[model samples]
Target chain A: MPDRSVAGPLTDPGPSHPCGGTSPRTGEPDGRPATAPGCNGRVTAPPDDCLARNEWICGAYLSSRRDILWGAVLQHLQLTAVSVLIGLVIAVPLALAARRWRWAAGPVLGVTTILYTVPSLAMFSLLLPVYGLSASLVVAGLVLYSLTLLVRNILAGLRAVPEETRQAARGMGYGPVRLLVAVELPLALPAAMAGLRIATVSAVSLVTIGAIVGYGGLGNLIYSGMNTYFKAQVLTASVLCVVIAVAADLLLLLAQRLLTPWTRRQS
Target chain B: MNILSEAWSWLTTSAHWYGQDGIWTRLAQHLVLTVVCLLISCLIALPVALVLGHLGKGGALAVNISNIGRAVPTFAVLVLLLLTPIGRFGEGPTVVALVLFAVPPLLTNAYVGMREVDQDVVRAARGMGMTGRQMLFQVEVPLALPLIMTGVRIAAVQLVATATIAALAGGGGLGRIITAGFNLASTAQVVAGAVLVAAFALIVEGLFELAQRLAPGRVRGGNTG
Candidate 1:
């Protein structure tokens, strides 16, 4: 509720007029002991030195920190993309194995479920000693978290291919791997896509937790903003994260539509 | 090897288990936060979802809107709340953030569960001279119990995991141990704290799984038509 109200007008830029007021100590360069005029008490002018480094208004902050922000966004995208991709690669084989060997499904799903349930913060800290605050630590945790969803969905998709279809494929002299790739994988696209959407968004979110170890995407901006009490920086970074998540989700939905036009027509 | 040995030593150190900052105290605090948030989220989300489900109108919109809550990071919400005036009160901001985070699954599952109940069964109950309330409670609810329980289980596990964020916002929880470890640069202590949180989540997951199994026979392990 508070987040909604706070973030609601993030893109409006109507507050830019108020932030233009000259900071009190701008002449002294330190900008110390000054209140930013006109802007709701949401922000205080950082020391002029800090202000020079980081812009004040939301728009200016975007432009001023564009390089850093873009880098963070790219990093964020990379983190989510790489983690989900890796998870998908691992999950497909595991799901296939589970399908072929029923006994393995239980233990495999159980292990992933446990990994998924581990709190992100705890998982990160648990690996700190072994990985020493590296991106690999975050990626490992994220990949594990994505496993439950990815594997379940892939299996569901593969299973959702009617038994008759599998039987028909076999009757056509298709071998196991060929049948899987040519027949099963195409049919399983929708479910797998759905899983991808969820995993990507979730990874985007979990990647922010990596900020604790100083590897977060927009999360770094959020942490800095909180520490410095810069409302613009915090709001901007948070908004961008939500934006990225929604965009990624929508793109996947479109891909699903393109891949499964039959489902769309039926719907 | 050194890390494991250090972790074991840190965990075994009895002094870490007592006092205000001890593992026991933080664990209790974490449990309390999680349970309280879960209860509050259920109270807020369940009735609305159930009633909407029973009515079979406007439920889709409610569920979709709540999905947006899932998209937003709980950590971002927590930080945003702490910036607002409500952050002044003890535990208020953390509770609000956690409750918001816990809502979407509970709301979605409860609604879907109710909707998934057999229509013929509802009609049968009504034919037997049952009041709407009676039909809802005696027929629909029992059928929907499994899914409703599933939602609760999900919310419970999620709350247990996310409650660790409370320490970041100055609220008490097991996360304090991790943060303290970070401050002290004691990797063993951090690992120990992480183990505690992860173990607690697994235990909660296990308890909920047991509860699901222990549901009434008619409602257990059977899909509603």
Candidate 2:
């Protein structure tokens, strides 16, 4: 509406786009008015782009979708981090309770196992009523799924701390709280970290299921790409998810080794 | 607008459960898809796992491969396969993606389970004039049944859950009900669909647990999926 008369170099649709864009909304361009004056304000697809070619591995798509892909990646990471952290926070106390009281273990483990068995789709759908299609729905579902893994491992680690070790700690003037914080928790790191690694990796994979909702991050890109059969976006986003999962697992494994150097191989 | 009551009514409606796209049809599709995928996965995974586990070779490689496989998101695989030429074959991609998914757990458990069987038992079987096949099926497999059942159970339950992806790719499943609800903006249908899928998965899991409980060799294998 401002000035269609002046077709500047920036507005050049190039030799490819005879009409501006395929989008019929003339004059008011769909996105980033790349229309030129020569074409009579009818913006069209790019003349020579991988996007137009619909190639599976399009560098142009990557460059153009850099922000979108990056945003999806970031959102994916944020969701994974937040849910796993929250899961950890909630799992520790539950693990402790399960370990402290014999009666609580069955109920805690039983409930979490049942939750884990719930399909991610069903889990999200079930939660949709409560969380209302938001990212929290994904996070809440993930946290609950993580509970089965985290609680079991954390409890196992705590249990694996030998009675002799506990007695020794107590003999050294360590109270129950101090023994737990200083000795028991550190000894429990190996198993707990293994659980964390698995939980984080699985969470990375599960976050893609969040695409069912609008907040799936890379999952959103993947979903829309799949709908449109956008080859490059789907491939790229899926590969990125894999890379993130492997990277997170490796990072956690490294952390586990560093934290529990005693568990390292003799070599 | 109580969601529970709405969902209850949605479920109670006779019309919703009596057509080609009815709840029954969808549930059957979901079950069939799940069973087919599980069968295919078992066929592909069990033999390889049993062989590798029996040989005590490639166990590490197999396990590592399965680890990588698990890292790959099932949804991405589903979409990727759907986008590829395989998508031309109806439900091919969904089946492939699900088989790929169901394999890792089955293979890992079977391989680990087979490898974990007591060596003394294997020696005793060999001493009793058992051939490799005989030792494998009779002694090794029997010893590993608990873990093998665990793997089968895990894979079965997972397939039941993930088969819902079939609906996304234009196939039939319980997921169609949910997606249709989304399209129609019917929260009740969505809830009803979700409840059905969740309940179905739980029932599958429970049945497996029951089978494992009743089965011999209560060797507490594969404690976690």
Candidate 3:
């Protein structure tokens, strides 16, 4: 909607001229003897105007690239980190309780599962009445979405711990709290990390949807581009999102590898 | 009229509306979209997953890719696609975005189900002169079906939820009603839309559960653990 008239001049290629008339190096449009063809039977330097046009294109590309890379990465990291932290705080306790009391698992899983099955926007709209169109609503929705995966993984990891290990820990005079913290938790950490990884990636992806409600992120660029039918903006944002996803995935995989060396050895 | 009678009147009216081009029509469209997206994604993902599962070398990579795919928000993808050349085509973008949204679970389940098939059973099938193709269809697939069904179940639920995002792109679905309710600040309408969606998801899930239950013992037995 902003004045697009300014872009008109840039898009105009202007009048065509013979390629050999002007000095390609100076780009001053001065009449000069054309440069001789080199051993490859072609002039290495482009015509001066062509070089200028290419320079303009390159500049545009660089600026857009920088804007997208920095903007998307910053938004993605901020959203994922805060959401995952909040999710972990809630999920870990719920998971532990679910493990200790089998009955609690049903309701806990049931609620989270149902919440998980709600669409992101619908969930956002559900919260909007209470929280308004604010970042809090977005965060709250994301945190809820993350709970199912985190809790399920934590429970699975705990349950997967060998019964022999639990009995041995008990034999060592370890109380329930100590057994959980010292023995069971370490073993569960890998699975917990896997869950966190999934949660973090999901949070990053979902944060883009937050743009719809004015909680700006990389998705903002995507939405703006789409709304206006801007291919450069759309392609740039989409590619950036994929790159961010892949990068986050690799980084988390490395972190998981570092945290659970036993996994590496077993594999 | 008393509140009970008024409520019943509203319910009956709503049911009549549903019978028309009202909530039921929207719900049916949304359900169909959800089913088609989920079914197509499952169909496409399953074979690739089975191949990967058989290879086993890139299980981690395949799972990681699917996890990343699953993580990307459907709405984000929907909105992002709206900007492309494809976005000019409108609803096509929405469908593609939804398909992308549904692919991860389908792929993961198919791969995991097959990989989890008992190695001894696969070996015995091979030893009994079953070709690799025959082993996969006759032995492995039967054993993996339950897990694969679980994956389909998960994908089905997810797609139903995610299809609401299509409404944002101006595609018709129950989400249109929900979004309209939001725009108008009508909680009842929003609640109505949500309840309908939830009911739809539950119904589909229940049907899939029944199908899973009715599957042959070879398909359903070992994977429950």
Candidate 4:
């Protein structure tokens, strides 16, 4: 709250908004406060000349125009959710196979490891020929990247079920499928959930790179903001990505706690 | 296969391998950026992690804060830095952004590695009247080598991938090749640029794996993440 008159001139909130055509925030005529005498108390607006100066925050994040930001956020979430779900779906079966065959573990882990090492931008560009700049290309790359984390964790979770526990179940005449469903899978859930959390956060960040191919969720805002030198949009988009990633991570943490009561007790 | 051949042909063209905007120059630029940023990140992350791990305090908080930090996209950080006063220094902002992107794994793995050192061995060192500094440098660091190297490997490989954002920020890197290809609408060139980055990352990863294998056998099996 330091001296509004000095700060007022720097940020004018002028009519030069990118969206053009005055919105509700800018449409008000004579926004300057004439009632305040010589920059004293109860200063509502600024002097007339200040309003003509350039605004740091453009119309991109203006209240009336927030739907654009909302749409971008939804796109970001959708990209993350879809890619992570696909990765989880593919990883579970692969993890199970590796657990069973033993030999499958090497190649499965190796291939996914190589894929994970590929840069997100490089992965997207590599698939350009096959996918032709579609959002699916982004999803496809993300799913491949997610595989290593999910598979490793899922396998680790399954392996974590003690041999003694498995022996006890088998002694009870539990079938392989029944033992897996009732015992192993449930025990593996916590680790698998941890993998899911990591994968989801990674996907959220990676989706921003999809902007290069014209499919980034909040990334589009950042790209455009950089090009146009609009600070607000870039800040807004970056903040949103952080919020989404943190929120997704925290929610998954909550889910893990709720789903694995035994783990909490042991801890 | 068709794309591979096209990429190969694009890569081998003499015109693509020379001059300021050539593949070799861009590759050099990308390598320099990656190395410099990696060094800076190691400087910032390692000492902090090592001390915390030695003290056996605040390791979890440091690691968690870094995980949250990771969620901030590199590209976003680059863009934000570019719009600020710091952006005037050209490569400064890009390097800053890359350092931020690479720090978390280095910090986490180093801390985890240090903490994972055998408690009995630590007690033995203490019984022998070794100083804390001596114990940390002589005992813990040697035991932590595999995991520390694993962190370096992860950060190096990630920086190679993440360095592409440099081109967008008016800095030099192999990402310029990809962006140039995109501008020219040449799929072959784009693929070639990507192949180079992927190849570079694989080579870096391989080198780290080799180094990890060369460590003491007991430490070689240490957990990476």
Q: Which candidate is the best by TM-score?
A: 2
Best-performing candidate as measured by DockQ: 1
Expressed as tens digits, the lDDT of each residue in A10-110 for candidate 2 is 11121122233442212122344344343555554334455555566878767776788888899999999999999999999999999999999999999
Considering lDDT, which of the candidate structures 2 and 3 is the better prediction for this target? 2
Worst 10 residues of 1 chain B by lDDT: B216-225
lDDT of 4 at B128: 96
lDDT of 2 by residue, B190-216 (tens): 899999999999999999888767654
TM-score (0 to 1) of chain B for each candidate? 0.95, 0.93, 0.86, 0.92
The reply for model 4, stretches above 4 Å from the true place, is A1-60, B216-225
What lDDT does candidate 4 reach at residue A113?
Answer: 92
Query: What's model 1's lDDT at A266?
Result: 81
What lDDT tens digits, residue by residue, belong to model 3 across residues B1-225?
A: 243343334335755356443777777778778878877887788888887887675688657666677656676567556544576674667678878867788788788888988898889988999998898888888778887888888888777777776776566677776666655565555555655666677777778878877876656664433
Q: TM-score-based ranking, best first?
A: 2, 1, 4, 3
Deviation (Å) of A263 in candidate 3 = 4.6
In model 4, what lDDT does residue A248 have? Answer: 96
TM-score of predicted structure 1, chain A: 0.79
lDDT of 1 by residue, A45-79 (tens): 55344344333344656666678789889988988
For candidate 2, give the lDDT of residue B27: 89
TM-score each candidate: 0.88, 0.90, 0.77, 0.87
Label model 3 with its docking quality class: acceptable
**TM-score for chain A in each prediction:** 0.79, 0.84, 0.75, 0.81
C-alpha lDDT of all candidate models, in order: 0.79, 0.81, 0.69, 0.80
Per-candidate DockQ values are 0.47, 0.44, 0.25, 0.45
